[model samples]
Target: MYSLHLINKNIGKFYENIPFSGLTSLRFMIVDENVQDRESLKNVLEFLGYSVVSVAGYTEASKHIRAGENYEFIITAIRSDSCMDFEKFLLSVKDFLEDSSVVIASERAEESCFQSFENDEKIAGAIHKPYKMEELERIIKSVRQ
Candidate 1:
Protein backbone atom coordinates (compact mmCIF):
# COMPACT_ATOMS: atom_id res chain seq x y z
CA MET A 1 0.00 0.00 0.00
CA TYR A 2 3.04 2.29 -0.19
CA SER A 3 4.53 4.03 -3.21
CA LEU A 4 8.29 3.63 -4.02
CA HIS A 5 8.94 7.22 -2.94
CA LEU A 6 7.16 6.66 0.35
CA ILE A 7 9.16 3.48 1.06
CA ASN A 8 12.48 5.21 0.32
CA LYS A 9 11.57 8.16 2.50
CA ASN A 10 10.66 5.87 5.38
CA ILE A 11 13.92 3.97 5.06
CA GLY A 12 15.92 7.19 5.18
CA LYS A 13 14.04 8.38 8.20
CA PHE A 14 14.54 5.03 9.96
CA TYR A 15 18.27 5.21 9.53
CA GLU A 16 18.47 8.85 10.55
CA ASN A 17 16.46 8.15 13.67
CA ILE A 18 18.99 5.61 14.92
CA PRO A 19 21.40 7.02 17.53
CA PHE A 20 25.16 7.18 16.86
CA SER A 21 25.89 4.98 19.84
CA GLY A 22 23.41 2.40 18.59
CA LEU A 23 24.89 2.42 15.13
CA THR A 24 28.53 2.17 16.28
CA SER A 25 29.14 0.63 19.65
CA LEU A 26 32.39 -1.06 18.72
CA ARG A 27 35.22 0.58 20.71
CA PHE A 28 38.83 0.34 19.54
CA MET A 29 42.18 1.03 21.18
CA ILE A 30 45.21 1.77 18.99
CA VAL A 31 48.74 1.57 20.38
CA ASP A 32 51.74 2.59 18.33
CA GLU A 33 54.95 4.52 18.83
CA ASN A 34 54.87 6.25 15.46
CA VAL A 35 52.86 9.42 15.84
CA GLN A 36 51.98 9.82 12.19
CA ASP A 37 50.98 6.20 11.66
CA ARG A 38 49.00 6.15 14.88
CA GLU A 39 47.02 9.31 14.10
CA SER A 40 46.44 8.32 10.48
CA LEU A 41 45.01 4.96 11.45
CA LYS A 42 42.87 6.53 14.16
CA ASN A 43 41.48 9.10 11.73
CA VAL A 44 40.66 6.44 9.14
CA LEU A 45 38.93 4.20 11.67
CA GLU A 46 36.99 7.13 13.11
CA PHE A 47 35.93 8.17 9.62
CA LEU A 48 34.69 4.63 9.10
CA GLY A 49 32.41 5.06 12.14
CA TYR A 50 34.36 3.17 14.78
CA SER A 51 35.15 4.75 18.17
CA VAL A 52 38.93 4.81 18.64
CA VAL A 53 41.36 5.72 21.40
CA SER A 54 45.03 6.09 20.47
CA VAL A 55 48.03 5.85 22.77
CA ALA A 56 51.74 6.32 22.08
CA GLY A 57 53.03 3.30 23.98
CA TYR A 58 52.32 0.37 26.25
CA THR A 59 52.29 2.34 29.48
CA GLU A 60 49.32 4.48 28.49
CA ALA A 61 47.47 1.49 27.12
CA SER A 62 48.10 -0.42 30.33
CA LYS A 63 46.62 2.37 32.38
CA HIS A 64 43.39 2.22 30.41
CA ILE A 65 43.27 -1.57 30.69
CA ARG A 66 43.93 -1.39 34.40
CA ALA A 67 41.12 1.12 34.82
CA GLY A 68 38.69 -1.42 33.27
CA GLU A 69 38.18 0.34 29.97
CA ASN A 70 36.74 -2.30 27.71
CA TYR A 71 37.65 -2.11 24.06
CA GLU A 72 36.17 -4.54 21.59
CA PHE A 73 39.32 -4.32 19.47
CA ILE A 74 42.92 -3.52 20.39
CA ILE A 75 45.26 -2.72 17.47
CA THR A 76 48.90 -2.45 18.54
CA ALA A 77 52.28 -2.37 16.91
CA ILE A 78 54.58 -5.40 17.34
CA ARG A 79 57.52 -3.23 18.37
CA SER A 80 57.96 0.04 20.25
CA ASP A 81 60.97 1.94 21.46
CA SER A 82 59.64 2.24 25.00
CA CYS A 83 58.22 -1.24 25.21
CA MET A 84 61.13 -3.53 24.46
CA ASP A 85 59.10 -6.69 24.85
CA PHE A 86 55.95 -5.98 22.90
CA GLU A 87 54.85 -9.60 22.84
CA LYS A 88 55.16 -9.83 26.59
CA PHE A 89 53.06 -6.69 27.01
CA LEU A 90 50.30 -8.10 24.86
CA LEU A 91 50.33 -11.40 26.72
CA SER A 92 50.32 -9.66 30.08
CA VAL A 93 47.14 -7.71 29.28
CA LYS A 94 45.32 -10.64 27.68
CA ASP A 95 43.79 -11.63 30.97
CA PHE A 96 42.49 -8.18 31.71
CA LEU A 97 40.45 -7.88 28.54
CA GLU A 98 37.23 -9.81 28.43
CA ASP A 99 36.52 -11.14 24.93
CA SER A 100 38.57 -8.35 23.32
CA SER A 101 40.44 -9.07 20.10
CA VAL A 102 44.12 -8.07 19.94
CA VAL A 103 45.50 -7.39 16.47
CA ILE A 104 49.22 -6.85 15.92
CA ALA A 105 50.41 -4.40 13.28
CA SER A 106 54.02 -3.90 12.28
CA GLU A 107 56.23 -3.50 9.24
CA ARG A 108 58.52 -6.28 10.41
CA ALA A 109 55.85 -8.82 11.32
CA GLU A 110 56.32 -12.03 9.37
CA GLU A 111 54.68 -15.40 8.91
CA SER A 112 56.98 -16.83 11.55
CA CYS A 113 55.89 -14.30 14.13
CA PHE A 114 52.25 -14.91 13.34
CA GLN A 115 52.83 -18.65 13.56
CA SER A 116 54.25 -18.24 17.03
CA PHE A 117 51.02 -16.65 18.26
CA GLU A 118 48.73 -18.75 16.08
CA ASN A 119 47.92 -21.00 19.01
CA ASP A 120 47.35 -18.09 21.36
CA GLU A 121 43.62 -17.32 21.52
CA LYS A 122 44.23 -13.72 22.53
CA ILE A 123 45.86 -12.92 19.20
CA ALA A 124 43.04 -12.33 16.74
CA GLY A 125 45.08 -11.34 13.71
CA ALA A 126 48.04 -9.36 12.28
CA ILE A 127 48.49 -6.75 9.60
CA HIS A 128 51.69 -5.58 8.03
CA LYS A 129 52.29 -1.86 7.77
CA PRO A 130 51.58 0.10 4.56
CA TYR A 131 48.30 -1.76 4.32
CA LYS A 132 45.40 -0.38 2.36
CA MET A 133 42.26 0.82 4.08
CA GLU A 134 40.36 -2.10 2.63
CA GLU A 135 42.88 -4.52 4.08
CA LEU A 136 42.58 -2.96 7.51
CA GLU A 137 38.79 -2.92 7.32
CA ARG A 138 38.78 -6.56 6.27
CA ILE A 139 40.92 -7.49 9.26
CA ILE A 140 38.70 -5.53 11.64
CA LYS A 141 35.54 -7.10 10.26
CA SER A 142 37.04 -10.57 10.45
CA VAL A 143 38.07 -10.08 14.07
CA ARG A 144 34.64 -8.68 15.05
CA GLN A 145 32.98 -11.71 13.55
Candidate 2:
Protein backbone atom coordinates (compact mmCIF):
# COMPACT_ATOMS: atom_id res chain seq x y z
CA MET A 1 0.00 0.00 0.00
CA TYR A 2 1.03 3.59 -0.49
CA SER A 3 2.35 5.50 2.49
CA LEU A 4 -0.36 7.32 4.41
CA HIS A 5 -0.27 11.10 4.15
CA LEU A 6 -1.12 11.59 7.75
CA ILE A 7 -0.97 15.24 8.77
CA ASN A 8 -1.02 16.52 12.31
CA LYS A 9 -4.34 18.41 12.25
CA ASN A 10 -3.56 19.77 15.71
CA ILE A 11 -0.26 21.29 14.56
CA GLY A 12 -1.69 24.79 14.21
CA LYS A 13 -3.26 24.48 17.60
CA PHE A 14 0.20 24.36 19.14
CA TYR A 15 0.61 28.11 18.47
CA GLU A 16 -2.78 29.07 19.84
CA ASN A 17 -1.93 29.89 23.44
CA ILE A 18 1.51 31.41 23.39
CA PRO A 19 1.46 35.18 22.99
CA PHE A 20 5.15 35.38 22.13
CA SER A 21 6.45 32.48 20.11
CA GLY A 22 8.75 32.41 17.14
CA LEU A 23 11.91 30.82 15.88
CA THR A 24 14.78 31.91 18.12
CA SER A 25 16.79 34.33 16.08
CA LEU A 26 20.42 33.59 16.80
CA ARG A 27 22.91 36.37 16.11
CA PHE A 28 26.63 36.12 16.76
CA MET A 29 30.01 37.59 15.90
CA ILE A 30 33.54 36.37 15.41
CA VAL A 31 36.48 38.50 16.54
CA ASP A 32 39.74 37.00 15.41
CA GLU A 33 43.04 38.50 14.29
CA ASN A 34 44.21 35.92 11.78
CA VAL A 35 42.66 36.57 8.43
CA GLN A 36 42.32 32.90 7.63
CA ASP A 37 40.86 32.02 10.98
CA ARG A 38 38.47 34.91 10.89
CA GLU A 39 37.24 34.07 7.44
CA SER A 40 37.04 30.39 8.11
CA LEU A 41 34.99 30.94 11.25
CA LYS A 42 32.72 33.36 9.45
CA ASN A 43 32.10 30.90 6.66
CA VAL A 44 31.39 28.09 9.05
CA LEU A 45 29.00 30.14 11.16
CA GLU A 46 27.16 31.30 8.10
CA PHE A 47 26.96 27.76 6.78
CA LEU A 48 25.43 26.73 10.08
CA GLY A 49 22.68 29.31 9.53
CA TYR A 50 23.52 31.94 12.12
CA SER A 51 23.26 35.68 11.77
CA VAL A 52 27.00 36.34 11.98
CA VAL A 53 29.14 39.44 11.98
CA SER A 54 32.92 39.43 12.10
CA VAL A 55 35.76 41.78 13.02
CA ALA A 56 39.48 41.45 12.59
CA GLY A 57 40.50 42.60 16.03
CA TYR A 58 39.36 43.75 19.41
CA THR A 59 39.14 47.44 18.52
CA GLU A 60 36.94 46.73 15.57
CA ALA A 61 34.83 44.40 17.65
CA SER A 62 34.48 47.03 20.36
CA LYS A 63 33.36 49.59 17.83
CA HIS A 64 30.70 47.20 16.57
CA ILE A 65 29.45 46.44 20.08
CA ARG A 66 29.41 50.09 21.12
CA ALA A 67 27.25 50.82 18.10
CA GLY A 68 24.32 49.51 20.22
CA GLU A 69 23.96 46.23 18.37
CA ASN A 70 23.02 43.00 20.10
CA TYR A 71 24.43 39.53 19.60
CA GLU A 72 23.67 36.25 21.30
CA PHE A 73 27.10 34.73 20.84
CA ILE A 74 30.70 35.89 20.48
CA ILE A 75 33.62 33.79 19.20
CA THR A 76 37.03 35.36 19.54
CA ALA A 77 40.67 34.42 19.34
CA ILE A 78 43.60 36.06 21.11
CA ARG A 79 44.46 39.37 19.50
CA SER A 80 47.28 39.43 17.02
CA ASP A 81 47.92 43.17 16.57
CA SER A 82 47.09 46.56 18.02
CA CYS A 83 43.81 46.81 16.17
CA MET A 84 42.04 45.72 19.34
CA ASP A 85 43.08 45.90 22.97
CA PHE A 86 42.34 42.34 24.03
CA GLU A 87 42.06 43.03 27.75
CA LYS A 88 39.62 45.86 27.37
CA PHE A 89 37.62 43.89 24.82
CA LEU A 90 37.30 40.93 27.15
CA LEU A 91 36.17 43.11 30.02
CA SER A 92 33.54 44.79 27.90
CA VAL A 93 32.12 41.48 26.78
CA LYS A 94 32.02 40.25 30.36
CA ASP A 95 29.90 43.25 31.26
CA PHE A 96 27.08 42.36 28.90
CA LEU A 97 24.31 40.28 30.44
CA GLU A 98 22.86 39.28 27.10
CA ASP A 99 26.22 37.87 26.08
CA SER A 100 25.11 34.26 26.29
CA SER A 101 28.26 32.52 25.05
CA VAL A 102 31.96 33.09 24.31
CA VAL A 103 34.60 30.75 22.94
CA ILE A 104 38.19 31.91 23.19
CA ALA A 105 40.73 30.23 20.97
CA SER A 106 44.15 30.18 22.53
CA GLU A 107 47.50 29.08 21.19
CA ARG A 108 48.34 26.77 24.04
CA ALA A 109 46.84 24.88 26.93
CA GLU A 110 46.83 27.82 29.21
CA GLU A 111 43.82 26.67 31.14
CA SER A 112 44.35 29.61 33.44
CA CYS A 113 43.15 32.07 30.84
CA PHE A 114 40.06 30.00 30.14
CA GLN A 115 39.42 29.53 33.82
CA SER A 116 39.74 33.22 34.52
CA PHE A 117 37.19 34.12 31.88
CA GLU A 118 34.77 31.31 32.81
CA ASN A 119 34.98 32.40 36.45
CA ASP A 120 33.52 35.76 35.48
CA GLU A 121 30.04 34.18 35.80
CA LYS A 122 29.12 35.21 32.26
CA ILE A 123 31.60 33.43 30.05
CA ALA A 124 30.17 30.07 29.00
CA GLY A 125 32.92 28.21 27.15
CA ALA A 126 36.32 28.34 25.45
CA ILE A 127 37.64 26.48 22.42
CA HIS A 128 41.36 26.14 22.12
CA LYS A 129 43.10 26.61 18.79
CA PRO A 130 43.02 23.81 16.18
CA TYR A 131 39.50 22.77 17.00
CA LYS A 132 37.21 20.77 14.75
CA MET A 133 34.04 22.11 13.18
CA GLU A 134 32.05 19.70 15.31
CA GLU A 135 33.37 21.39 18.42
CA LEU A 136 32.15 24.73 17.21
CA GLU A 137 28.69 23.34 16.48
CA ARG A 138 28.51 21.73 19.88
CA ILE A 139 29.38 24.95 21.66
CA ILE A 140 26.95 27.03 19.65
CA LYS A 141 24.12 24.61 20.35
CA SER A 142 24.99 24.65 24.04
CA VAL A 143 24.77 28.41 24.08
CA ARG A 144 21.46 28.46 22.31
CA GLN A 145 19.99 26.06 24.82
Per-residue accuracy of model 1 over 1-72 as CA lDDT, tens digit each: 111111123212211121122326788898898886787667656755779999998888988998899998
Candidate 2 lDDT, 88-111, residue by residue in tens: 677765555366566777768878
Candidate 2 segments exceeding 4 Å error: 1-24, 83-85
Clashes of 2: 1
TM-score of the candidate numbered 1? 0.77
Runs off by more than 4 Å, candidate 1: 1-23
| Best by the TM-score measure | 1
- Per-model TM against the reference: 0.77, 0.71
Per-model C-alpha RMSD: 9.5, 11.6
**lDDT leader:** 1
Over the full model, what C-alpha lDDT does candidate 1 score relative to the true structure? 0.71
